[model samples]
Target: MSDKKALNFTNWDTTFDNGTSEDGSRNCVYMSESLDYKWVATSCVEKINFL
Candidate 1:
């Protein structure tokens, strides 16, 4: 058996609020454990630390 989690349902929307088009350009979702697990939309090219 593995220790990794199965899934987490934050029910966050995958919309870019930076006035950017959601045409697979800025299509990335991330959650910050430091910020009380808040969701943030970012670029797919960005380097982030995953939990």
Candidate 2:
């Protein structure tokens, strides 16, 4: 639920660093479940139970 910078969903930014997302899907910022809760970029279309 952490974003690279302070951003609100109403005006969320879709920009990412040079190599931010592994799958090249930088739609939303979410915490990784299998990576010890590290922040990662994922597609906003995906349904995640956790926030």
Candidate 3:
């Protein structure tokens, strides 16, 4: 029911991409060029360092 989605496979929870559930605690998602421009999810308060 939320916009939390993972465009790429993650070592963390997979529900973000499956849309099966919404993780209110971690509401941040971004695309990673290293992973072929796939999406990654994390906490909004955390800094995303990708190159």
Candidate 4:
């Protein structure tokens, strides 16, 4: 019989907030332990503007 390793899974809690501004500027925030929160924000904005 062949031996193999099972994949491991992680449980994470996340928080998101709408960063809408009064001037009609749209923004978003995401928080997770697996990644840098700031990076997520920057990446999201970049994607939105790119579209």
Candidate 5:
């Protein structure tokens, strides 16, 4: 549930959605490539973004 910046990359920025997802099933946050890499909430468990 943490992010890259939390690991010491201060200059980096994370673009999150307006808020958590309305769908109760989607509780995880991920970078959306279709939305220009903005952080979007989803239930996906296969893809993992790393620093």
Candidate 6:
């Protein structure tokens, strides 16, 4: 009989420039599936900071 294995998963968060005249923020999330990977990008203008 052949052996089977479960898929491995990972999560990541990062910030990037939005490349616009107005100040923009970008939030990204990534997931890996075997040799392939997928990502989601969100763009916003509002800023939130906590101190």
Candidate-wise lDDT, in order: 0.65, 0.57, 0.58, 0.40, 0.54, 0.40
Model 1 bad stretches (over 4 Å):
1-17, 21-24
Sorting all predicted structures by lDDT, with the top scorer first, yields 1, 3, 2, 5, 4, 6
* TM-score, per-candidate, Cα-based: 0.48, 0.43, 0.42, 0.20, 0.34, 0.19
Best by lDDT: 1
- TM-score, candidate 2, is 0.43
The residue pairs found clashing in candidate 4 are none
lDDT of 5 by residue, 16-40 (tens): 4434445436666666666676566
Candidate 5: segments with Cα more than 4 A from true spot: 1-23, 44-51
- Give lDDT tens digits, candidate 1, residues 1-51: 287877666755444364454455667768866556678777787789886
Segments in model 3 whose C-alpha atoms lie over 4 Å from true places: 1-24, 49-51
* Model 5: lDDT of residue 16: 45
Candidate 2, which segments miss by more than 4 Å at Cα?
Answer: 1-25
Candidate 2 vs 3: which has more lDDT: 3
**Model 4 bad stretches (over 4 Å):** 1-26, 36-39, 42-51
Q: How close is candidate 5 to the true structure, as a TM-score?
A: 0.34
Native-referenced Cα lDDT, model 2: 0.57
**In model 1, how many backbone clashes occur?**
0
What is the C-alpha RMSD, rounded to one decimal, of candidate 5? 7.6
**Model 2 has how many clashing residue pairs?**
0
- Comparing 5 and 6 by TM-score, which wins? 5
Q: Looking at candidate 4, what is the lDDT of residue 24? A: 49
**lDDT assessment of candidate 1:** 0.65
